[model samples]
Target: MKNSTPKANFESFSFSEDILSAIKAMGFKKPTDIQLKTIPAVLEGKDVLARADTGSGKTAAFVLPLLDNLSNQNVYLRRGRDERFDSSKRAVSN
Candidate 1:
């Protein structure tokens, strides 16, 4: 998808404050054309299928948007239970 807004340095795009801080700390100052095009679409919840030449910053295009979603959701983390409680143990013994 083409953007009507003229491309600017990636730093100029308004992002969530945390995301912007992390991007700056990672030392990225500009967006490659793929990043410029894809990030916004992904942020807007569009399913994107992009084709780009090697080394065209495709990784950042996907990574940044995905990270944004994950960070926003603040997903839960849980530990597994002991396997010894399984009902299959009784079936196997029988």
Candidate 2:
């Protein structure tokens, strides 16, 4: 049997429009190898421990999927003077 392959492009990650727009605006043509490997698990709320050299897109690897997860929820108010994002553990200013 063949081993499972990771998703190739950022589009395959099924990110929300805002995230996708931000990615494009940032000129990220695609995910890095590490991102392709771990984003799915991260989005699934599974733990991940990765080590990569500096500037391996590691921050984006975790941040993008985490942001996507957060966006999937109605965690923030539509309009508020003090906007916040509520999570299971804590809430943060928007």
User: Model 2's lDDT to the true fold?
Assistant: 0.79
Write candidate 2's Cα lDDT for 1-94 as tens digits: 1224777778888998888999999999988887887788888788888888898899999999998888778674434666554643345555
Error of 1 at 23 (Å): 2.2
TM of each candidate vs. truth? 0.68, 0.75
Residue 14 C-alpha lDDT in model 2? 92
Q: Model 1: clashing residue pairs?
A: none
lDDT of each residue in 15-85, candidate 1, tens digit only: 66677788889788788888888888887889899989998889888888777676667454432442222
lDDT, residue 6, model 1? 47
Report the Cα lDDT for residue 61, model 2: 92
Cα error of candidate 2 at position 14, Å: 0.8
